[model samples]
Structures are given as structure tokens and as C-alpha cells.
Target: MDLHKPPAGPPAQPPVPASAQPPARTPEGCLVVAIRLPVRIVVLVLVLPVRMAWDALVVAGRFLGDAVLGPLGRALSWLAKALLLWPLIGLWRYVVVPVGKALGWLGHVLLVVPVVWSYRQVLTPLGYGLAWLARGAWAGLAWVYACVLTPAGHAVRWLLKGIGTVLAVVGAGAYTAVAWLVRFLIVVPARWIHAAVLVPTGRAVAWCARGVWRLLALLVTGIGVVLYWTVRILVVLPALALWRWVLAPVGRFLAVLAREVGEALGHAWRIAGRISSAVGRLLGTLFRWIFVEPVRWVYRTVLTPVGHAVRDAVLRPAARAARSVGRAARQALAAARETARQTRADLRRMLFGESLPREAVGRREPSAGETRTLGRSTTALTKD
Candidate 1:
């Protein structure tokens, strides 16, 4: 039996089915389940209303969709057919067709006609003119380039190229000589001095820089701490004191005052509302009792009876008398008009020798003296 070697044993057995196994027991779980069962009942009780409402809502939706939707959809379809489709068909047939035709006519007349005219008359000729002008400009530009620009550019390029190269060479040589001389006189000495003196000086400066940096860091940290404490002492504590001593108390007092004022206002408002309600009720009662009811009573008890009596008694007699007066006046006026016509005719016959209408009555025509007397009477009546 080596330590590393496994001890061979029986093979592992498959687990038993839960139905075949004995039930596991946990007292704590039973206790927890007992506690949680009541909690679940409470939760169910709490959620019962919301769940019922949700189910009711679902039922209502189903009812609306299953029962009401068909009629509503049919109504909407009928409206669409009657109001939308019919009117749209009519508009397309009558109005839209004519408008489209008019717009097409306008487009042809205003846009197409102008475009065609411009293309033929203005744009075509202008294009030819521009082409000719462009040709002339091209020729001129070619001539100027050939005569002036090309020669000038060549001459300038050659001069610049030659002079720049010579100047650059001389300047480069001078710069190289000056560079070496400066290096010999200054840079070499400076490098030697840097290796000998500057290295130590730089180390001293670096050490000083580190000391200064450490001091600055300490100072900054100390300043931050001091600032923090100062703020706590100067600003924070004072703010806390103000809040505790003054602001909080003031806020509480203001809240109490506002509540009192609101309560007073509410009380006053209720009183005023009651008073106004009473006044309105009194006024309504008075109006109904003194005006509406009394007027209705008077109309019913006195006015209607009086009106009927007057219609039967006074108005009937008056209407008959008016009719009699009107007939008598019409007959008198007609008779007077006939008499005037005869009299006027007689007067005309006397003055202008015109025969009187019904010239002789019973062979006793009116005499001249009678005619003259009739004329005078007629003139007086006309004057009157």
C-alpha cells in the first residue's frame, strides 16, 4: 500500500429517486414556513385588490373588444365611407381634376413657354456669344503667355536658381567656419567646464531642489490641514451655530406662524362662505317668494282673468266700432271724390270749352253761373 496509490473500494451507487426516499426534516424550516405562510397570506390580502382590479380591467377590455368593437368598427367604417371616401372621391372628380388641369396649363404657359423661348432666343445666342468671347480670351491669354509670361518666368527662374545656389554655398561655408571656430573657442571650453565644475554644481542644485520640494510638500500639506481646521472653526462651526440657534428656531417659528395664519384664513373663509351662502339663500328665497311666485300668482289669479274679460268686453266692442268708422269714412271719401270730378269737369268746360263728362243729365245741363259758383267752391276746397 503505497501512499500515492488509491485504495480500491466498491463503485459508487446511483442516487435514489425522491419518491422512493424518506422525507427530510428541518424544524427551523418548518418554523420559517409557518411564519412565512401568514406573511404570504397578508401579502395575498394586500395584493388581492390590485389583482382583482387587474382581472376586472382585463375582463372589461375583453368585453369592449369582443362586444363593442364590431359596432364601433362598423360605425367608424361607415363614417369613413360616408364622410371621407365619398367627399374625397367627389373632390378628386370635381375640384382636384380641374385644379390639376389649371396647374398643368399654367406650368405649360408660364414655365415651359418661357423656357423654350429663352432656350431658342436668349440662351442659345448667349452661348454662342460666350463661346466667341472665350475663344478671343484664350487667344489673348496664349499671346500674352508666349510673348511676356514665359520669357519673364524663364529669366527669373534662371537668375534666382544661379544666384541662390552661389549665395547658399558662400553662406554655408561661412557658417561652417564660424561654427567650428565657435566650437573651438566656446563649446569645447564649456563642455570641459561642464564635466569638471557643472556636474558637482548640478548635483548640489538637485539636492537643494529635493530639499526645497520636500519643504514645499510639507508646507502644502500643513497649509491644507490648517485650512481644513480653520474652515471648521471659522465657517463650519459658525454655520452650525447659526442653524442651531437662529435658522432652525426661526424656521420653526415661521412654520408655526404660517400654520396659524392658514388655519385663521381657513376659518375666516369658512365663515365667509357660510355667510355668503346664507345671503344667497336669503336672496333666492326672497326673490322666489316676492317676485317669481308672486308674479306667477298675480298672472294666474288676476292678469289672465282680466285679459280674458277685456278681450270679451272692451276689445270686441272697440273692434266693431272701428270697423263701422272705417266703412263710413271710406264711403264719404268716395262720394266726395266723385263730386269733385264732376265739378272740375264743369269748370274746365266753362274756362277751356271742354265738354263736361255726362254732358247733359235729363236735358238740364249745369248753367254757366252754376259752373262759376262750383269753380269757386272747388278752389276753396282745394285750398283748404
Candidate 2:
């Protein structure tokens, strides 16, 4: 039989008896159900003990934590008291009390001096000067007003105007006389005197200037020689002595200052070293008491118990659950791989004309054996 040959019979139809057709089965619907009702009940039973243990552990952890923290809180309270209370007491005793007493004494001493001294020395003289000036100015203004504004003042003003006119006429005559006298007597004689006096005065001034210049030059040369000798004897010798004296004092002061500063610095360094050592010891003690001991206690009392409880209860169960999930996932992956491999093999067999498994290709009724053979023959024609 040819595998590619078509069927010769007509198609037959099934009789319809159902009210409705059933839904088609999908690939997802073919999956096997692994978690059954019994497994779900077993999972619930296993989780119950873990939850109870976790709740008990949480209660125990809270109790242990409170117990550990209680001592630490009290210690912190004592530390705060030491840091704040002692310093406050010292400030009140040392600083505030002494400052108050000193201020009170200074205030009492200040009250002893005359309070009016400031006003008398600083303000009263200035006030008196101002009053005197104001009185004088007022009196002068009153006298001027009386002189210029009264009836007698008008007559006196007229008399003064007449006297002024007479004086002006006299002054004009005197000025003309003085002008003529100056031209005749002063100007002519002044010109003759100037001409007569200038030659001798010039010669005298030149002689005096030459004499003065020579004297100045001589004095300057004497001064220069004297200053040179004086500088060598007096200025230079004294300057050297003063330099030595100044340097001696300065060097002594500097040496003393250096020694004092060295001593001070050494003392400060010793103090600082002592303070540093004390601080280091204090910090070490604090660390041991505050951090190390408490941490050790917490680890032993609270954390250890809590860690053990969590490991036994929640962590162990969670780890087992994760492992079970991983195993299930691996099994599912393996089954899926097997299924994929089987499907690939079946598809290969179908497409490549290979025989499939008897289960995959269903069994059918036997029919007559019909075989056909194909042959090829050659016919030759010869020409003579």
C-alpha cells in the first residue's frame, strides 16, 4: 500500500445525541496536579508549630531586650547627671558667687566719691560761660537799640553826621597837603637816598654776603671735622656701647622669654599628656562598660536565645520550604524536558517516514495485501 494514496470511501457522520458539545482541551489543561488536598493539610500542620515557636521567641526577645536595656538606660542617666550637674554646681560655687561679691564691692566703692563732681567739673563751667556770653550779647544789643532808636538818639545821630562831614572835609585838605609834602620831601629825598644808599648797601651786602659765606664755609668745615671726631669718640663709641647694652638686655629678655616659654610649653605638654591619658583611660572604661559589656551581655542573653529560636523555628522551616520549592522546580523542569524530548522524537518520526511507537500509532483492523511494482525497460532500434 502506498502511504500517500487517498481513501476511496465516502465520509460518515456521527448521530447527534448530546444537547451541547464539550469544550476543547488545551495544552495547559493536560498538566498533572501535584499538590493535592492531603499535601495542603500536611503543609498547614507543619507551619503551625513554626508560627507558635516564632511568636514565643518574639515575646522572649522583647523581655530579654528590655532587661538588658534597663541597666544601660540607668547608666546613661548617671552619665548625664555627672556631665551636667557637677559642672553646674561648680559654676555656681566658683564663678557666679565670686563675681557677685566682686561686683557688689565695686558698686559700694563707686558710691563713695561725690556724685556732683562730674556735673561741676564737666557741665557747670560750660553753663556759666554760656550764660555770661548771652548776657553780654543781650546788653550790647540793648545799648545799640537805645542809642539808635531814642529821641536823643536822633539828635546824637545828626551831630555825628555833621562831625563826620567836617572830618571828611578836613581829611581831604590834609590828604592834599600830605600828597604835596610826599612829592616834595619824601619822594625826592627817598629817590636821592635810594640812589645814594644802594651802591654802598650793595657793596656792603656783597661784602657781608662774602663774609657770611666764608664764615659759613669755615663753620661747616670746622663742624664737619668736629662731627667726624665727635662721631668717632662720642657717637660711634656710645652707639656701640648702646648697641651692646640694648642687645644684652634684648638677648637676656629673649633668653628668659625662651626659657619661660619652653617651661610653659613643657608644663602645658605635661598637662595635655595627663589629660590625654586620663581621657584615654576614661574612654576605655566607658567603652568597656557602655559598649563591650552590654554587647556581650546582649549577645549572651538576648541575641543568642533569639537567634537560636529563630534558627530552630522560622529560619529552619523557611529554609526547608525553599529547598522543597527548589526540588519541585527541578523535578518540574526535568519532566518538562522529558516531555519536550518525547514530542521532538515523535515529530521526527512522523516527518522522516520512521516507524512510531505502537502506543503512539494506534492499532487498526487488517485489510487485503495489495502491492504494486514499478519497472523500467529499454527498447533499441538498429539501422543496417
Candidate 3:
């Protein structure tokens, strides 16, 4: 009965309070999210056309300004060039070139004029003076030749001829006198001197020879006695003493000297060895750095390429040429050898058609009796 009465009424539910609500979650410690590259790329793509259009507008405006001003700039530049070049060209043509040409002409004029004037004035005067002096000298010489030299020459000739005749006569007389005098004086005196001095000298020499022989005999006897004693006493004893006394000291000194020399040599050798070793090491290092390493590097880096180039461009051709030359030379040599062999055979045949017969050759030889005679003659010559 109650359910039938409430059937027309709606049911109601209870509400939750505000204090029972959960707290909101916050992203304070979370990593920042990044935008996708495609979105950024889309944005860039969207702005790129505008940027391109703006850039194109800016370039067009700059191009218009440049195009408008370009001829003006060129005109200003041309005016400046003209301003500089006109004055420079004018200066060169009017001042520098003309002045240079004038200076060259003036120098040539100065040189030529001075030289010509000097030649004409001073040198001509000096040459005229010299010519006048030479003419005067020639005239004076002619006068002297006519006046003094002619008479002097005649007188000198006369005197010379007279003197020559006199000298000849005197010389002949003197020669005769000298000959006679020399014969008389020299020959007579020489003969007398030879007779006198040689005869006396012969006697004296005979006496001196006897005395000298006696003296030499005494001297030889004394020398022999002295030599015997010296050999027995002085020489032998001194030599023995020298051997006994000096040899030990000499040997000792020599030993010490040899030892010192050996020690010095050893020291020098050691020092030299050390020096040589150090030098060798230094040189080896230097060579390695300067020559060996560089050469190796060049061989690797530079020489390899160069060698390859040479092989390609030069060496291969050279080798091929050499081979060809060698082949040609071999062929030439073969031809020459064949020709030589043929020529030698022809010469041999021309020289000798056939082998000589032994009997004919023997018959060409001398006969046995002739050979025996020749041998006997040779034996006689040998004996003589």
C-alpha cells in the first residue's frame, strides 16, 4: 500500500562535500617537453617565402640604386683618371720627355763641341807646333847634314879609312912583332925554363921522391904501428866499453821512449777512437737526417713520382731505344763479323791457294852442304 502511494514521487541521492575532493597533480619536477621538428619546419616553411620576398625586394631596391648610380660613379672615376692622366701625360710630353731629349742633345753637343773645339784649338795648335818643330828639326837636320854632317861624315870616313889603313898596317906589324916576340920570349923562355926548372925540378923531384918515399915509409910504419895499437887498445877497448857502457842506458832509454811512445800512441789511439766514434755517430745522425732520411723520404714521396714519370715518359723509351740500338749494333756486328770472316777467308785464299808442300818448302831451304858452311862460318865468327 505505501509503495503504491510513493510511486509517483522521484528518489533522491546524498551530495559529497568539498573537503573530500582530491588535490590537483602538478608537473614541477618533470622534464620540459620539446616541440616536434616537423611543426618547427612547417613554421619555417611558412615564413621562408615571406623572408625570400622581403630579401628579393631589398636586393631589387639595392640593384636599382646601384644601376642608377653606376654610370655616375664610372663618370667620376673617368673624370679622376682623366684629371690624373692628362696632367701626367702633358708633363711627360711637355716637360719630362722634352727635357730628357734636350738634356741628351745638350750632353751630346757639349761632348762633341768641347772635343771638336779642343781638337781644333788646343790640339790643332799643339799639332801645328809639333809639325813646325818637326819641320824645323828636319831643316836643321838637313842643314847639319849639309854643313856639319857632310864634312864630318867625309872626315870621319877619311879618318876611319886612314885609321883603318894605319891600324891594319900597325896590326900587321904588331901581329908580326907579337908573333916573333911571343915566339922569342915565350918559346925561348919556356924552353929555357923547361930546361932549367924541369932539369932542376927533376933532380929536386928525384930527391924529394926519395925523401917522400922515406917519409912515407916512416909514416906508414908509424901509422901501421899506431893503427895496430889503436885497433888493439883505443878502438877495440873503446868500442867494447861503448858497447858495455852505452848499450844499457841506450836500451833503457829506448825502452822508456818506446814505452812512452806506445803509451802516447795508445792514448792517442783511444782518444782518436773515441773522437772517431763520436764523429761517426754524429755523422751517422747527421747523414740520417740530412742524406739518408731525406733521400728515403724523397724516394717515397718525390723520387717515386719522379721515377714513375721517368719510367713512363723517359726511362721506358730510353730502355727501348737502348734495346733497339743494341739490336742494331748486334746486327751490324754480326754483319761485320760475317764480312770479316768472308774477307779473311778470301784473303787467305788469295794469299795461299792451297797448303804448301813440305817437300817443296824443304827444297826451297838451303842445301845441307850450304847449311854446314853457314854454320861453320857462324862458328868461326863466334870464336873470333
The candidate scoring highest on TM-score is 1
TM-score of each candidate structure, all chains considered together: 0.39, 0.32, 0.28
lDDT tens readout by residue for model 3, 33-61: 22233334454545455554555577678
Candidate 3, superposed: residue stretches over 4 Å from native:
1-124, 143-148, 155-193, 196-198, 224-228, 231-384
The alpha-carbon RMSD values of the candidates against the true structure, listed in the order shown, are: 24.7, 48.3, 58.2
In the predicted model 3, the residue pairs found to clash are none
Can you tell me which runs of candidate 1 are displaced by over 4 Å? 1-28, 36-89, 184-186, 205-384
List the pairs of residues colliding in candidate 2. Answer: none
Report the C-alpha lDDT of model 2 over 73-114, residue by residue, as the tens digit.
889889988999888999999999999999888876786344
Global lDDT of each candidate: 0.82, 0.76, 0.76
1-384 per-residue lDDT for model 1 (tens digits): 567977899999999998999888544435444444454455454554555455557767988987999789999999999999999999999999999999999999999999999999999999999999999999999999999999999999999999999999999999999999999999999999999999999999999999999999999999999999999999999999999999998897676555545555545455555555566588779999989998999999999999999999999999999999999999999999999999998998888996547754543433566554544553444543
Highest lDDT: give the candidate number.
Answer: 1
